[model samples]
Target: EQGHEERKSGTLSEPQEFHSGFIRINPDHPDRVLHQDIDNIENIRSFISAARAAAFSKPVIAIKTGKTAAGALAAEIHTGGKQSSDAVYDALFQRAGMLRVSDLTELFAATQTLAMHPKLLKVEQLTILTNGGGPGVMAVDSLLQSSGKLAQLSEETRAALNKVIPQSDMTSNPVDIFGDSVPARYQQALEILLHAKEVKNLLIIHTPSALAPSEDYALIIAQTLDKLPKMARPYVITNFMGEDAAYAARRLCSNYGIPTYRTPEGAVRAFMHLVSYRRNQKHLTQTPESNADDAKINKHAAKALVNEFLAEQQSYLSTHQASQILAHYGVECIQTEVAYTPTEAKEQAIELGFPVALKLISPSIPSKSEVGGVVLNLNDAQEVEQTAFAMLLRIKNTYPDAIIEGFSLQKMAPRAGANELRIAVKTEPNFGPVILLGEAGTGLEFAQAAVALPPLNMNLAKYLIAAAHDKGVLKERVLPEKVDKYRLCALLTRISQLVIDQPDITSLELNPILASNGQFLVLDATMTLSRYQVQSHRKRLSIRPYPIELVKQVTLKNNTLATLRPIKPEDEQAHQEFDQSLSKEDRYKRFFGELPQFNHDQLAKMTQIDYDREMAFIITQDNATLGVSRVLMDPDKIHAEFAIVVRSNCQGLGLGSLLMRAAIEYCQSQSVQFIEGITLPENTGMIELARKLGFKISRDFEEGSINMVLALTPIDKHG
Candidate 1:
């Protein structure tokens, strides 16, 4: 409509209209001249911008047609240039935040599902309803094909649904109503399923057949949906029909606020997309803090380099330059030096220490190993010289006209059991700066190992790291006897931010990220640059002094003063003082066991921990630290642990109870799981505090303290 007005007034430039129902791009005429005047890049950009804006406001879905060249040519004849048209449309639509549908059926389903339930609060739980076994099977197949899930029904939901369905019918998720189901039965089944506590969203499949009246079923479904509460749940309905029944079912479902699709596959795809978007939204709302130091480090290094690269208009940086960038981001890369000659290679190898790796450095070749440009485990000067010469010769033979800049001498890192970690950035038209992390091996690429699109935040970064496969490996086995999980998590967090902040990055490949001996290092790296490459910018979030007024309100003992405050990262010295004040026995009891020094990882986890579910508080009087308390919650909110470490000198002063009281109050406010604590049976001080706090104590094995449990009750308002 806007385009029509602009065209009539001769004010609009290159008017294009999207299909009303399916958001597919179609130019005004099919047969047209293939030139900039007809279909220019600017027009494409405008189209993309419009689509993206619509998607942001409401869910915009697209179905792309014309896969074969012939089909494309036909489309072009009806529109403009075939090949260019498809490419341009795809690039534009993707940027505009429209989900591309593979087929007509998929397109319909995606639009229908998205239109009905545009947003999701949770993605893990799903419920399905189908009338016939054949359609149910097809729905299951489509789900698997599109990576959609057939969620396992919770026991409670299963029991509830079973009450309304026959015993012969499948009671699990994807509840098949069978051929005998009538309008009344269908409505009752839907009501019971919707009311289940575990079902977050639902997918209904209604296949009109000879026996069942499809329109009648659709009417019943509509009536049931109308009776459901606004927040009961959202559902996608798919009706497989031939002409008359399909049209009737689609119109009926659409009229009643239900998104209707013609096929099951389309519905599943759209549902999965909704699920993903919901997950991202939840993550964005949860993670609030940004690491300023990491930003500063990256900015200081990226600015000058980005400026130089942009000035030269270089699409990619040399290995040496790339290494500098990695170092700036605090990523550990192999020890490397650019050597102009064999002698230089030997010299650099010796300087870097023995057992070095030699590689031919060429601007043209990105994958050195594939081209036989890499030589590993070259010990001594002679080995380095020979390997460097051989590598250079191999490069020369592989590409006779290739430019051989020089050789790179790098110290070979110890071969430890490690995984390939590739962090790449791919810009989607609608979604900006997607950071991908996966295992580096062929299997990872094949499996598409756990991908998370965390929206450029440190907390999301941490969550991504925790979700990765390497996290399990680090927790269960990584070496140095006790690998620093916190430090590794921080590294992942920093890497995510680096990719998000740096726009000049076209693609980055880091293979064989070795996690060994309590540290991680990058063995090889390749960083590609985009045409619009520019230096990265630093991000800073304002920080103010801790609120003193709020801290003073928290008190200990009869009128004794205690300060509440925010902790600084540089408080390691004071932390040590607080630690040393505890008896060896007390320290062991608190830490499980501890004798070594606290590393940066430990400090970061303690000081920069997320304040949402976990928090650390210190009780102090006149600048003298009395004790520290920490509240930890399980991810599922099923349980919480409160651990307090008080100074031996301050034990009997009721400081432990003060910290415990604060932790309990916090847990109750968060509506967290049960508050639990463990104390040595002999630690009568802690036991007494628990008893005074009205906790239910339970004694376990005699090896240590009795386990204490506290059930929080709402504080009385009118006491």
Candidate 2:
């Protein structure tokens, strides 16, 4: 409607609209232009996420449709198979740093917000200015509904606002200016709110009133907002109530590049788009530690466990077989064994100690508790035998068609009031495996589950755990010590890797995964397999997992055997320690200044990088931090920045040259046009290293740094 009005008034600047969702900026063009349309979405993400790994000056914004049940069905009908291929498209979009907006209103608001204050993506604080109590209340409710917090004014700020508005009216988040408030009152309130150092962003609201000069007040706020310095300005979103009369004011605000919304609720929702976008950008920059250890995953053993069940022509593995599978992957489960006879059950119970559980194993009866086929806490041999026999008799009469094999015996492991969790891997028709971690038990709530498409690493696993716990999905039981999160993250990574390796596994369930004391034990489980397998296993995951194939062991020039591999998420601590070991001078050469201790966010950004567009290689022997090399690719994936540092002790062993060669080769493979770095003029050692590697040396006096570039591959001549 706004565009039509602008077009009618001869002020429409942007005259293009696109059906193609993906966008790009080509240097060959005069300006940005549409290049391609999605003809097919067979491998949806390959196209949906084509721009995810590329480096861009601005964020890649996306619109995801079909999140609702009716919309999903329509999409499936239109697309011919899936409403969406990946169940976790939202997750995929987030990992790629794409800002996903719900509707056109949000798309416009969020774009304007980011355009005005790109740095505010991660800022969460908000302050409000309103002229009416009812509108102020609505604005506060909307912000809270979007999971946003209202910035509390300091005592000094409150006192200042109290002087302008009445004390009774000013004692709140939305410093409510009275209904009869004039332009001066709006001006004073905005000044007080914007200057409060606690404020990260500001929302100015106006509802139509008899005394309130809605249009005049908006122009006043706009002019005041325009005078603020761009560098320090918080993202300001305005809500000028009603339409026709407010159109000119809205246009005036838009002319100044300030975002104005139709409703307060829309404005808050739009602000959250910036919130979610920046949070995801943080997620993108944070991939430094891959947390991938090839030594941890034994593929041979995992395959062997799966094949045994296939050999027996069993589609579903029983609790005993399921426990064996988890055991191979280093996931602890209750010790379980199958007993063929009553005497065998008694012997198994005595061997496992008192208070063991006996469950009747059958093909048809999936849940033992349903058919009276489970016996828990059998204290003695006689009781075990009696319970085992009774369970078999009960299952035999009730489930006549069930193929009863034997009684499965497992120790009744106690959790001692630890958090009981449900971890399951379910497959989609085309998208492959999605892992769900949430509250456990038969009476599970849908709202309490958090889902992610895996292959997961320690960092991603840690994110899932924290998100679930924070959102009230994963709860803690009464326990003195909490469930150790590190161990849980490691275990989750293992489970994710296992599913990635075994393609035929249809579904897996580990209910009541008792988590406590840095240990996890699966109390009960069921794993089903299928003859059908995904053709391309790599495409199974929506987000690519850690690339374990890049890990290698090399002998340094000093004859020291060292492991040279891509940096993992767990390398944050090692990277920090490596930074601390550097001398003040060395740090100046590398970081270009004296360095303070690296904080968690800073260290995470340095270590945790998205493996898609960049690579970091570390050389370590006996887990000691020896040296590190990193190459960060531009959004275009063409230009790259290469940096290397070998600890002072390990210098002059040809390690620095070896790392440079590796980084160059890696960049060439990634189709990077050139690799470059800046060094202090006095850093002769680094300058010499660049010369030996056939790089062109130049001095950027303006930047006060020596610049070097090594072109690996030439650009395409045809274009």
TM-scores, each model vs. reference: 0.55, 0.77
Report the Cα RMSD per candidate.
17.8, 6.6
**Cα lDDT of model 1 overall?**
0.59
Candidate 2 residues 132-249, lDDT tens each? Answer: 7788888889888767788877888888888888655565788788778877877887887777777768888888767645678778877887788876766788888888877777
Give a tens-digit lDDT track for model 1, residues 277-314: 45433332332233424443565466567667767776
Q: What is the TM-score (0 to 1) of candidate 1?
A: 0.55
Cα misplacement distance, residue 591 of candidate 2 (Å): 12
CA lDDT of every candidate: 0.59, 0.71
Q: Please report the candidate that would top TM-score against the real structure.
A: 2
